[model samples]
Structures are given as structure tokens and as C-alpha cells.
Target: MFSTGQMIFAGLFVIAFATAIFITYQKDKKLHAKNYKGAVWVAVAFFVFIAILFAIKYTLKN
Candidate 1:
């Protein structure tokens, strides 16, 4: 079983990853001003990439 601290750390990592994606999407949207779809896909890909990383980390840890 994972410890409470480990769980919290994982949650924080996910949140930070999401926040970073959101910030990047916002910046790209503002900068490009016409490629909202591309920005959204980029954000989605980023989040998925982070999730995959987390999954791999957890799998290795266990």
C-alpha cells in the first residue's frame, strides 16, 4: 500500500502537470490567435504524456 505522503505527492504532481498544460495552452492560444484546435490538442497530448509518465513511474515503483 502506498503511504499517505506518497499519495499526496502523486496528486500534487498530477495537479502541477495539469496546471502547466493549461498555462501552455493559454500562452499558445494568445500567441497564435487562430489555432485554438491545435492548442487544445497540444494540451491534451501534454496531459496524456504526463499521465503515461506517472503510470510508468508507479508501475516501476511497485
Candidate 2:
């Protein structure tokens, strides 16, 4: 069980950590767009590959 002080510290820590991450992401937004232009297609391909693997497994299991 957490004490009142530990709970307060955890709440403050989460707020500070999230604020830091948001600020960092905003700072790098432009660089990320330029560097990761084709990233969506890569994600799509990964999903499709996984689907194919699942289909093969299903067929073999039956």
C-alpha cells in the first residue's frame, strides 16, 4: 500500500514526464516527418505479413 506522500509523488512524476515527452515530440515533429516518410507503408506491410502468417497457421491447424 502506498502512503499519501508516495501517491502525490507518483502523480507529479507522471505529469512532469508526460509534459517532457510532449515538448520533445513537438520539437522533433518536422525532423520526424522528413525522416519517416515511408514509415506508414512499412507498418502496413508488417500487418499484411502477420495476417498471411496467421492464415497459414490456421490452414495447417485444420
Candidate 3:
């Protein structure tokens, strides 16, 4: 039941979420090489951002 604009927005949101995950993974790889702890926090923050994006999208639809 979504309009074209809504669908496009949702797709873009998903892309953004995926990009965040990719960036986090790359950072994790570098951090792992350096033996840093920030990678865990980066992953946590990425998921939180994705969750927030989903919440906003659903809220808009409802």
C-alpha cells in the first residue's frame, strides 16, 4: 500500500543501513588488525541506527 515516494524512501533507508554495516565491518577489520575495542561499539551503534531507521519508516507508514 505504499506510495512510490514512500517506497523510494524506504529503499534509500535500507541502502543507508547497509552502507553503515559495510563501513562498520571495514572498520572492525582495521581495528582487529590494531587490537582495538572500538569495533564492538561500532557494531552496536550500527544496529541501533538501523533500528531507528526502521522505527521511523514504520511510524510514517502507520
Candidate 4:
């Protein structure tokens, strides 16, 4: 069982960590948009490829 102080510290740590991450992402948000324009299509293609593989596997298994 954690002490009250430890619990409080954990809560504060989580809040600080999330805030830091949010700020960092916000700073880079514009750069990310400019540099990764085609990233979404790449991700969609990757998922489609995986789905095709799974379909082939299921077909062979049956």
C-alpha cells in the first residue's frame, strides 16, 4: 500500500508528464504536417497489406 505522499507524487508526476508531452507536440505540430503529408496513405497501405495477409491465412486454414 502506497503512502498518501507517494500517491500525491504519482498524480503530480503524471500531470506534469502529460503537459510536457502536449507542449512538445504542439510545438512540432506544424512541422509534422509539412513533412509527413503522405504518411497517412502509407499507414493505410500498411493496414491493407496486413488485412490481405490475414485473409489469405484464414482462407488457407479453412
Q: Write the per-residue lDDT of candidate 2 for residues 1-62, one digit (tens) a residue.
A: 99999999999999999999999999999999999999999999999999999999999999
The per-candidate count of clashes, in order, stands at 0, 0, 0, 0
TM-score of each: 0.47, 0.91, 0.46, 0.86
Model 1, 1-62: lDDT tens digits are 99999999999999999999999988786567765546778999999999999999999999
Clashing pairs in 1: none
- lDDT (10s digit) by residue, model 3, range 7-26: 99999999999999999999
- Cα deviation at 26, candidate 2, in Å, is 0.7
Candidates in order have lDDT scores of: 0.90, 1.00, 0.92, 1.00
In the range 1-62, model 4's lDDT, one tens digit per residue, is 99999999999999999999999999999999999999999999999999999999999999
Q: Which candidate, 1 or 2, would have the higher lDDT against the true structure? A: 2
Clashes counted in candidate 1 amount to: 0
Tell how far residue 10 is off in model 3, in angstroms: 0.6
- Supply the TM-score for candidate 4: 0.86
